[model samples]
Target: MNYFKQILRFAKPYRIYAILNIISNIFYALFGTLAMVSLFPMLNVLFGKTDKVKIKPEWNGLLKVREYSEAYLNYYVTQKADQGNDDVLIFMVALVISMFFLKNIFSYLAMYFITFLRNGVLKDIRNELYKKTVDLPLSFFSEKRKGDTIARISTDVLEIQHSFLSILELIVREPLMILFTICAMLLISVKLTVFVFIFIPISGFLISLIGKRLKKHSDKVQKEQGFFLSIVEETLGGLKVIKGFNAEKIFNRKFKESTSRFYNYSNTLLNRQNLASPTSEFLGITVIAILLWYGGQMVLVEKSLDPGLFIVYMGLAYNILTPAKAISKASYGVKRGNAAAERVLEILNTSSPLQDKPDAQEKRDFNTDITLENISFKYEDEYVLDDFSLRVPKGSAIALVGQSGSGKSTIANLVTRFYDVNKGSIKIDNTDIRDLTKESLRGLMGLVTQDSILFNDSIKNNLLIGDEHATEEEIIDALKVANAWEFVKDLPKGIETNIGDSGNKLSGGQKQRLSIARAVLKNPPIMILDEATSALDTESERLVQSALENMMKNRTSIVIAHRLSTIQNSDLIVVMQKGKIIEKGRHEELIAKNGAYQRLVTLQSFD
Candidate 1:
């Protein structure tokens, strides 16, 4: 219930809908009890047990209104009997039908209003979850599974809707229905109703015992679902690898294992949750049977209760069972929903370690060099950048050549502040990158990675991400600069062609060219090319290298170089081994030293 109240704050926007639903529920409860109680007059008339009133019943106080109502009905029926009206029973039946009709109408109104509140809370929570997923630092995702996040946003939220938020239906309509029915039963015979109260608490306590372990099982079921979903997500993303390694059987076994756990957990949870309904109903019937024995004695043996009113009392007593059953089921739902609420609130309540300070402002442009001074950083226990430092002058192209895991790419990540250093600071034009707003700091640079991250959208839309208001001509010009215009114009739709998922419709080199065109469109003062052309064949690499040179013109560039020959003409070349810089100089100066750079060039046969 505490978890439920936390999520209820989202209903503030739709408070009017909730209020209207409560109002409708109050009427529905009133009408529902009246509908059952209306059966008494019909029963009395059918049994010919009604009394003939000699005088009209006087208006009595509220407490005795039930007696006055019965007295008035008796006088009307007796007058009709003396008038020789054969439609008296027909009129009574029609009145009963109208009471039932009004009851259903208000019941529908309650559900209709509650629909808005339930769905509105779902929309707001999912939107906030998605927003937080995007805003949290990338490091947050490193320790979590993507499918678990997807489950939190999709399945867990829906579970909360069904279990937690849907409790609104049970809280108002069902409880009030029980209250009204109980009150009506008291009016008919307070003695029988009092006997009912003593046993109901014991029944309620037993029903609650089923829900005690349900929450723990439900959490296990939800987590198992997330595990299987993660397996599916991983399998889809790695189909090519699975086929390449001929490990399809291995991954299939992994998926099967996760699904098997899911099956067991879900069955255990659902079967226990299913027990709540029958247990409550079975207990309710036991109470009803006991009421029959006692009430029958009061009427038949004791001669203290009337037969027709006792029949009405039994009808109203049965009415309470439906609501009691509903309440029992709802209690189980709340238990399950509590687990989902905890999962959802976990994301919403997490404080991001990466956020701009209150005094931060947008850094509009770059004017001077980028300086990395003795920056030390570690991802886990080991330092990836051990007291690394470098000075990249404005408009100068610096190429980084190193073996894999030599911390070349880490420099790109740090300069863009995708990560912050543990010990030292990076400055752009003498201002610490941390002091600048992340958005504006990143806006001053362009990044083109080796993987060529492109979306499934039209080529024009993809290019427009670099410049939203770019005209068609601007897109064509940027493509030409990327050496991609020739291939794009040959396609059927030219700039309007839809690139399939991750631009799969385009070839590797074409995708790379389009990626470069996106950065070219941005035309930032600084460019970071993280092995942008490394994955291409010789022909594709040559064309992409040409495009890279064109984009690097008049820009300060940091090139994480993969091909040794490509960076021979760079203004400065730095060779790295481990996390330390082993050599730094012009390409020719390093080649003359017969040092690490020269050895790597010989290996590539670029000397």
Candidate 2:
């Protein structure tokens, strides 16, 4: 419920709709009761049981207003009949019709007012969920499925809109309808009204019993939905791998298992939710049955109640059933919405462990060097970088090379502060990296990673991420330096062509060149190239390696590579084994030392 109230804060901008809705619903409830109450006088005059009034009724105290109003209406009917209008019965019928028409108009207005608020809250909540998802650190998603996150933002948000907003309407209009109906009943006969409510508590207890487990079942259903959606997400992302390995059947079976569980949970929850309507209606009929018997005694056996008024009381009594059923269904809706609200708030309330300190200063320069002093880091129980240290002075390039799992990549992760060190410090220009704002720190460095992370957007838009307002000449210059402009200019749309997902439409070398072009466009002071040309064909490698060399000119560069050829010309080369540095020197010095660096070059020569 606290989470639900937090969601409601998004509705603050749309509170005017709520106010107008409430005003319309007040009139809606008013006319809804009076529409039925208007039937009594018509029935009285039709049966010729009218008490002829000889004088006009005087103003009476507020407590006696009902009696005084009835007397005045009786006097009006008598006067109209004595004046030979002969349309007294027709007037009563017209009055009842007009009351119903106004009741429906107000009902329509009430719904019309709330429509925008409902959709507005939904849009704001989805926008907020997406904003928070992006703000969270990458490590937070390491333990969460992408599909489950998508389900939270899409499916769960829609569920909240339906259940909460619908129940919000129930909380207002339905109860007021019930309140107004009961008030009319009491004016007719307080005794009959008091007796009618005796069985309401029992009916309410039964309805509450039906919904006791709805929230638990709804939570189970939502979990199953997320699991199935995750399967779909993984399947689409790995379709090529699955087909290459002839593992389609295995993935199909897993998806089927997930969906089978989803089917079972959905049926159980919806069936339970579906039971609320009929059960409440049946129970309501039982209450009306009991009210008819009790109220019949006052009219038939006791003769204290007017036959006409007693029939109108029965109409009002049956009227309570509709709102009662609506309330019962809305109660179930609230239970389901609570489950979805819990999921959405779990993401929104999470605090990122990586945030810049309030006093953190922007780093605008890389004047001297980057220093890693006795740094230790871990991804799990094992240390990935233990007691490791390195430095790259301004205008120099340092290369890290080792066998896989030797923590070469972990150095890049730590240097960029993607993951903070568990111990010691990484400093830029004599300032601890943690003391610098993350945005400004990253702004000073450019990264080219193993995977080509391009969106399914036009090439021009993709390049614009490097500089949102880059002129056409700067974009062409960056592409030419990265060796990407040759093929781009030959394409059907040149740089305006749309690249497929993750640059699938382009060759491996082309994608790498585009990635490098983006970094070149940024033109940061420090460049980190992590195996930028390792996955390409020989021809592609030659083209991309040339681009990388052009991009690294006169900048501080940290290169992590498996290919010995790529790092041979680096100013300083460090050979690592099992998270410890074993060899560090110029390329020729390491080869002369006959250490791990020599063995690695010897092994790569055979490949």
Candidate 3:
């Protein structure tokens, strides 16, 4: 219930629709009760029990209001009785039909308004969930499956809409209908209505017992759904690897195992949910059967209660059954909804560690240089970079040459503030990067990674991510600067060409070059290239290396280099080993030293 209350806040934006729905439901309940109560007059007319009255009934106080109303109705019916019983019967039937007609109309209207409120809340929740997903730090996702996040946003949200949102209708309509029906039954006879109340609590208790474990089962089913979805997402991402390794049967068996659990959990949850309706209905029938025997004794043998009124009381009692069944079903829905709301709120309530400070300044420009001072960081336990210090003077290409696990890429990540340092500070022009707003800090740099990260979008649209308002001529110029225009100009749609998933439509070199072009379009003061050409073939590397060289000119660049031949012209080549710089000098000066740098050059020459 606490989780449900939290989810209901999303309904605030559509509160007007909620208000409208409540109003319509109120009328629907009123008319629905009246439709059943109208049976009292019709029964009296059918039984020929209506009596004629000569005098108009006097207005009585509220205590005898029921008697006064019955006298007035009898006076009117007696006037119509002179017309014929057939005509009076027709009028009574017409009155019942009108009540039913109005009840159904309000019922339709209640559903109509609720549609807007329900879907509006759905849209708003999904939108907020997506925004939260994007805003969370990368480290948050390190321990979570992508498919679980997807399931929370997609299926779990839908479950909330179906289950929790239905409570809005049940809250107003069902209880009001029951309240009105109970009031009318009390007007007819308080003793029998008291008997009806006794069975209700017992029925409610039984229904509750069945639904007690529904939430636990529902949680298991949703988790299994996420598990299977994760397997599918993994399978799609690594389809080629799976085929190359011939592991289809392995994945198939894994998927089947997950689904088998899901099947059992779903059946258990649904069977419990399905039990609510019949259990409530059977309990209601049992109450009804008891009322018939007790009321029969009072009417036929004791002659204390009227037959027509008892018949009407039975109709009103029967009217309580529909709403009771609905309420019992909705109780189960609320339980299921509680489980779903917990999953959704888990994401929404997570506080990102990377949030900017209240007084964080917006630093938009890069003047002077970037510096790392005694920075220490870690992803989990052991530090990836410890006491790492470096400086990049403006407009100089500083290349980091290192063996794998030498923390070259870790430096790139720290510079970009993708993950902040555990100790010490990274400063731009002497101001700590943490003091600057993340947006403005990131705006000063461009990044190109080992993998060419491109989306399944138009080539033009992909470049627009770097500069959304870039003109055609500016885009073409950036492409030329990255040496990508040659291949791009040959494609059928040229700049407008759609690059398929992750730009798989382009060759490795073409993809890498476009990534460079995107960075060039931003034209930032600092650039970080993390082994950007390592995955390419010889020919592709040559082309991409040329593009990198062109883009790095006159810019402050940090290059994490793999191919020893590529960074020979760099202003400073810092060779690192085990997170520490073992050698630092220009390429020619390092070659003259005949030490670690020279050894690396010699090894590459042999390769």
Full-model lDDT for every candidate: 0.90, 0.90, 0.91
Query: Which lDDT tens digits does candidate 3 get at residues 379-460?
Result: 8988878888889999999999988888999899888888889999999999999888889988999999999999999999
> Which residue pairs show collisions in model 1?
none
Evaluate model 3: give its TM-score: 0.97
Q: Taking the candidates one at a time, how many backbone clashes does each contain?
A: 0, 0, 0
* lDDT of each residue in 325-393, candidate 2, tens digit only: 999988898899999999999999998777889899988878999999999899989998889988889
* Residue pair clashes in candidate 2: none
Could you tell me which 10 consecutive residues in candidate 3 have the lowest summed lDDT?
45-54
TM-score of each: 0.96, 0.97, 0.97
Q: Which runs of model 2 end up more than 4 angstroms from their true locations?
A: 83-86
Task: Name the top TM-score candidate.
Answer: 3
What is candidate 1's lDDT per residue for 458-479, written digit by digit as tens? Answer: 9999999999988899999999
Q: Which stretches of candidate 1 lie over 4 Å from their true place?
A: 76-84
